[model samples]
Target: MRIDSHHHFIDYSEAEYPWIDDNHAAIRRSFFPEELKSVLDTHNMDGSVVVQARESLQETKWLIQLADQNDWIKGVVGWVDLCADDIEQQLQELVQLSPKFKGVRHVLQGESDDRFMLREDFRRGISKLAPLGLTYDILIFEKHLPYAIELVKQFPTTAFVIDHIAKPVIKEQSFAKWNEDIRKIAEYPNVCCKVSGMVTEAHWGQWKAADFAPYLEAVYAAFGADRLMFGSDWPVCTLSGTYSEVYQLVDTFIAQLPAEDQSKIMGETCVKFYGL
Candidate 1:
């Protein structure tokens, strides 16, 4: 199955997404399943893993409901208060509701500059997830790489996918320090990278497939096709271009690689990583 491993959704009536409210000019409106289905069909995507954008249990349940209603949503990476005292109990309740709830995400990208990831309670809570057969999505910037690497070392068995290639700002063409940190993270066998969120990082209106090739190529070189996966980061990628445009960019790049390597990076890696 061809799975787009990362995508976001919102239901205005179900719950309020405070983050998008501030200043995400292009995506202030609702992003419904119908629109997502159109994109999926256009790109021949069999299904997708609907990821969490808000930090609300209601949003998580809402995504599960969408998955039930839409066959295109093969899986979901929902969110919950990882630091909640009853996190383990909460995950048990969710797993009973739907087997499609494949993993959990904490939007650490929005964390304060302080030691959020290294906190005692957060570490305790994260340690509880792996035994429940749940994976954690790391949505963080380069600064959080040290903490992420530490987490991987602490939980060597926990499966973690690095979302959006660490949200690199490729438009600025900045990579001196970030590249070193990324190389360190790539050393972990259990960690994987999602080749998503590139268009938004590039010169938004002037982005081309070529602009992203170098970055994607670097990831392929560092992690190899077995560990890299293509993700549309839809709604978010819409900020730079259409779903077809983004997919075609990745398609062209992968076409340049060997067929087996192409298959691994384009879809197969996602299947193996997410256990789809």
Candidate 2:
């Protein structure tokens, strides 16, 4: 079954999503599964993994509810306060509601401290995830790549996927450092990467598919098809291009691979990673 490994369903509310600054007008409204399914259906995508857009247990439960209601939603990568002392209990509470709860993520890119993941309380939370059969999604920007490498190295047995390919600074043509860092992290078999969110990092409306070539080539070289997965980063993708446009760039880029390799990057790898 084909899957868009990462995307978010947002019930837009100003208070809940203060991060929706003026530049992000397109995604300020709600984006639900019914509408997403309509788009995915046209692409012959069988299902998707709904990721956390907001960090709230209530939102996590709500996402699980959405998954339970929609058979087309294959899994969920929701958020939990990994730093909280009762994190395991909180995960159990969500699991009690449904096994659709597949993994956890922190907007690690949003954290000011580069090594925030190594903090005592946060490490305590991360230690609880894999033991419960859950994966962790490393969400960060270029500066956090080293910390992410450090984070994944220590958790070698836990399954992890770097979100947005570490949100590389494509706008500035930032490459050499990111290229080297991505290759270093991929040295660990426990880590995979989502080839999503590149458009917004580019020159937005003016981005050409060719602009992604070098960056995509770097990641594909680092992770290869077996450890890479496709993610639309949707609604947010609307900031630069339509869902079709975003999906097309990645789909077209990976089209060069062998059919079996393409199959793993498009869907199968995620199924095995999250055990969906």
Candidate 3:
């Protein structure tokens, strides 16, 4: 099965999603499973792992509800207050709701603290995931790479996938530091990387497929096909280009690998990582 491992479904309401203000007019409206299903079908994708766009247990529950209704949605990477006093209880409650709840993620990219992932409370929360058979999605920018490396090291048995290949700065065509950090993080066998959200990081209007080649090459070199998975980033990706365009970017790159290696990056790796 071909899996879009890291996309989101946003049923936008100002009260529910204050983050989608005038700044993001393109995706200010709702984007539900039905909408994504069309795109997936057009691309001949088998299913997707719907990730959380907002950080709330309410929204996470909402996603579980969506997954419950949509057979095409293979899994969900929802959010919970990992630092909450009753975090283990909260996660247990969520897991009980649906077997599709495959993992957890926080918008670590939006936080000001570079070392936020290493906080004792957060680490304690992450420590609870392995026992529940849930994975953790590391969502952060390039600057947080070192902290992510340290965070992953602390939980050697827990599965962690890096969202958006750490979101390299492709618009400016910068990669030296990001590449180095990615290579370091890929050293850990427990961690994996997603080839998603590249278009948004590039010069949105002017980005060509070639602009992503170097970054893709770097990640492919570091993670290899076995530890890499494909993601479209969907509605956010539409800010720069269509879902097909985003899919094509990664699809074209992975096509270079042997067929078996291509199969792993496209879906098998995600299935194993999230137990989907």
Candidate 4:
């Protein structure tokens, strides 16, 4: 199956999603599974993993409900208060809701503290995951990679996938620092990388496919096809271009690999990583 491992479904309610502001006006409205079905069909994708955009357990529950209703939504990477005192109980309740509730993610990108993932409480929470057969999605900027490397090292068995290749600064054509940090993180066998969200990071309107080549080449070399997967980032990707445009960019890049390796990057690796 061809799976887009990292995309989101948003039902825009101000009370439920206070995070949406005028700044993100481009995607301020709701984005449901129906809206995405056509795009997925057009791209010849079989299914997708709907990732959490909000940090609320309510949002997680909502995503699980969506997954329960839609067969095409193969899995969900939802949010939980990993550091909550009753986190174990919370996870138990979530898992009971649906088998498609596959993994957990926190928006580490918005965090001000660069070393937030290394905090004892957070690490303790992450330590709780492996026993439950859940994976963690690492979402952060290039600056937070060092801490991510440390965080992943502490939990050698817990599966982790770096979202948007850690959101590198492709717009400015900057890569030296991100390239070095990503290479270092890729050294950890437990970690994987997503080739998604590149268009939004580049000069949104003016970016050509060529603008992403160097960054894509760097990640492909560092993670290899086995550890890499494709993610559309969907509604957010629409900020720069259509879902087809983003999908085509990655499809073109991965097409260079042999067919077996291409299949892994497109879907198999994601299935193995998230246990979908």
Q: Please give the lDDT score for candidate 3.
A: 0.91
Q: How many clashes show up per model?
A: 0, 0, 0, 0
What is the C-alpha lDDT profile of model 1 across 181-276, one tens digit per residue? Answer: 788888988889998888888887687667776677778877999999889998988877878888888888888899998888778998888777
Candidate 1 lDDT score at position 77: 95
- Candidate 2, residues 1-276, lDDT tens digits: the string is 799999999998999998997988778899899999999999999899999989888899889999999998989999999999788899888878898899999888788888898898998888888888999999989888898888887887888899998888888889999998999999999999999999999998888888899999998999888899999998898999898998899889878889998899899988888888
lDDT of 1: 0.83
| Model 2: residues with Cα > 4 Å off, grouped in runs | none
Question: lDDT tens digits, residues 138-174, model 4?
Answer: 9998889989989998999999999999988888888
Better of 1 and 4 by TM-score: 4
lDDT of each: 0.83, 0.90, 0.91, 0.91
lDDT head-to-head 3 vs 4, winner: 4
The weakest ten consecutive residues by lDDT in model 4 span 15-24
Please give the distance, in angstroms, between residue 229's alpha carbon in candidate 1 and its true position after superposition.
Answer: 1.1
Off by over 4 Å in 3: none
Evaluated at residue 115, the lDDT of candidate 2 is 89
